[model samples]
Target chain A: MQRSNIYILVFSAVMTVLIGGAMSLTSVLLKPAQDKQVELDTKKKILGAVMDISTFDKPEEILNLYKARVKSVVVDIEGEIIATDDKGNPLIAEKVNAQKNHKIDREERLYPIYMILNELDPNVVEAYVFPMFGLGLWDWISGYVALESDLNTVKGVAFDHKGETPGLGARITEEKVRNRYKENKKIFSDAGNLESITMVKGEGITGLSMHEVDGLSGATITAKGVNKMLKEYLGCYQSFILNTRGLNGIAIN
Target chain B: MSAEATVVEKELKVEKKSAEPFLSKRRKNIVTDPLSDDNPITIQVLGICSALAVTVKLEPTLVMSIAVVFVIVFANLIISLMRNLIPGRIRIIVQLAVVATLVTLVSEFLKAYSYDMYKVLGAYVGLIITNCIVMGRLEAFAMANKPYDSILDGLGSGFGYAWIILTVAFFRELLGSGSIFDFKIFEAIGWATFPTNGLMVDSIGAFVVLGILIWIQRSKSGYVEH
Candidate 1:
């Protein structure tokens, strides 16, 4: 009934080692699959910004579709493409961790842009998707905003978050909520200034203007976070947008 | 000669007890008591936080329930097996270490196999380590019971917790979203105009639904508080 102090110490030591070892082994074994899931999820979000991917059940189908329709490029804050990192590793746009990039200085961040191409005509660009990351009320909120080839009209938007309050700020992930941005909201004004889309105060408000979308009712802080995220990230991508527009022979104001 | 005969008779009785049926009445009670009379969430009032948090929708709640069941069952069995070797002084720590390892395994498995469910469940999966029901069962039943009995107790308590949360989720999802498991019931049945109650989607709705559930379950089971 009575265990000596040494006996107790040895028991606990052994228990700690056994459990820790087993857990680490399982984690290492599962790491590849977990990484693949994360990669697929990010790709799905990027693709979800421009098209409905609900029907794509298999991972291969999604990957193939991405391969066929999507092209990516990593550009610096000044709009110049960076093909590789300083270590000579190829910088793939989909591989860029937006959350990590969000922590870096604005001037030094590498932004990824996914260009959706017309299926029948590869030469015709369809939509451009930009990844946006920022602070939500309780944690980080991120999203993808796809712009029509004209580089002004919003094609679609998909938002995601970590640790946001359910039924409130978490509604940002809902299709109905994301549709607010996709409802013909423009990111630029006629003068070519990057106005960015804004989520106005209060929910269920109709008659939204060209650059305005209704905000979540009880999540003013998160709504503000989304607004600021869009404005800031879009501003960061303004140079790239202008350059691409110019390349397409569209006059830049 | 008489004393030797009595000893033989006692040995026969002991053999009979060991050979008792697997699903004997007493063991069955251990697996059934928590379902109604000794419900973990309603009667015992343990693990109510997750009962409220994850019940906003049915799918995530179902996943949470399964994860909790897996954690509790294994934790109980392991603790019971090590009951004798575990020092009384450090038993709680040992129990915690076992439970934490199991929970981590469950989360990792979920992350690998069911990424969408993992994302939806999110931190709630990690919070299973903190759910008092798992710890309560280990401390109350597993630490002193046989391994088989501990497992049954875990099943009883797990199912007890699962059903309660699932019930809460059913109503919340139905009323909040006009759907079951994200399928729009109203839209499918030609009643697309059914307006969902926003309150049901919030945590307060969970509280309301659980309160009503507890009330109904207790009244039916005739469980009275002192």
Candidate 2:
């Protein structure tokens, strides 16, 4: 063939080799940093949901705040707390070290997290922490919420969603939606019962029991899924919520 | 000798006539054209995939648009500079190599410096490689034009795509969140302390945005013509 044909074939081979080399190098080089980012982000999501952290400038600050305010432990099926790793893996008592090994599933280990606000805040009272998880329109919606001792009043709440539409059902990430769980709170009924937060189908939730909130009308399925998850998942810690409520009610009254 | 001379004259005239003034004014054309008469996304419709995703939020869309502008302009300039040396058969592979390398670097910077916006953008940053605008500028005007001209073409096309996207996203986020750039612009009734904000934070919010954008773009620009 002509000179152009020969040159083209050789140049094609050279480019192919270069691109293949770059892709492999990128994967290997970015592995550690990428993994760290993912882990850090996940921790931030969990803590941000439960912690009173509005603006902490650094990751170190976030980690420090989590260390100081949030205490985590493995629990048994019957509300027994275990300081040791539930399934026998050990790195530290409370810290998660993804670098060394993987921790067992939360179900197998029964992980419970408690996050506290400022101890000096005079309004602060008995904190209630519960794990909530459920099916969403597309995937699982899960997170933790902290409420005041009153049980009807919200202290703070955080939520994380998977596979939801951006700017739609995913608006759950916005402060307005997530923070809506604050004050004038509703986690129980006038009957003094724990009914999962329900999506009111009619005329939006107005003066309904603390057990209901007006969910997104068009995205009701996702809202209902979140309701179910928060209810079912928090049910595992029922004895804790009830036992504390019983004790607090007697003392406060 | 007479017949040979005649044939040569005819060949020259045919080449000059068919090529138009465009082929001859290369030196001047290099400095301009992409500004309007040769615009990319509007006139060319190259990149829309990112426009659809990033425009939902203005801040992320701003970052994304800039990153694309940098990649496209530089990719075009670099590709055009090496155009002559590139083997004709392997040109596309070379084009993609340069584009992919740039995209990966931007993705890394985003992950490191602006994780929040990066989260908002998600995989769309990596999807820059597939943005037809970049490749189109590289192949069509960049390859044949001078380095300076290719850069302008890149910028012009990028602006075209960026403005259209921001317009769409501005309306989308404004109507959807009742917020701009995550700041509450409107608070829903009976939901806040001030009663000043209008709350559009419902599922209908997103649909309202999609409807307005589709209607606006289609009706005014003669786009989505049926």
Residue A51 of candidate 1: its Cα lDDT? 96
For the second chain, the TM-scores of the candidates in order are 0.97, 0.70
lDDT per residue for candidate 1 within B31-56, as digits (tens), equals 99999999999999999989988999
Positional deviation of residue A21's Cα in model 1 after best superposition, in angstroms: 1.0
Model 2 chain A, poorest ten-residue lDDT window?
A93-102
Candidate 2 has what TM-score?
0.68
lDDT of 2 by residue, B107-196 (tens): 876776676666676667888999988988888877887787687677777776677667666766675545678777666444334332
TM-score: model 1 vs. ground truth: 0.95
Assess every candidate by TM-score: 0.95, 0.68
Give the per-residue lDDT of model 2 (tens digit) for A112-229: 6464545566334446565556667877666667766665456666666656665556656667667666636666656656665665653345675555665664567777777776
Per-residue C-alpha lDDT of model 1 across residues A55-174, encoded as one tens digit per residue: 988999999999999999999988999999999999999879899999999999999999999999988899999999999998999999999998999999988888777678888988
State the local distance difference test value for candidate 1.
0.93
- Model 1 alpha-carbon drift over 4 Å, by segment: A251-253, B1-7
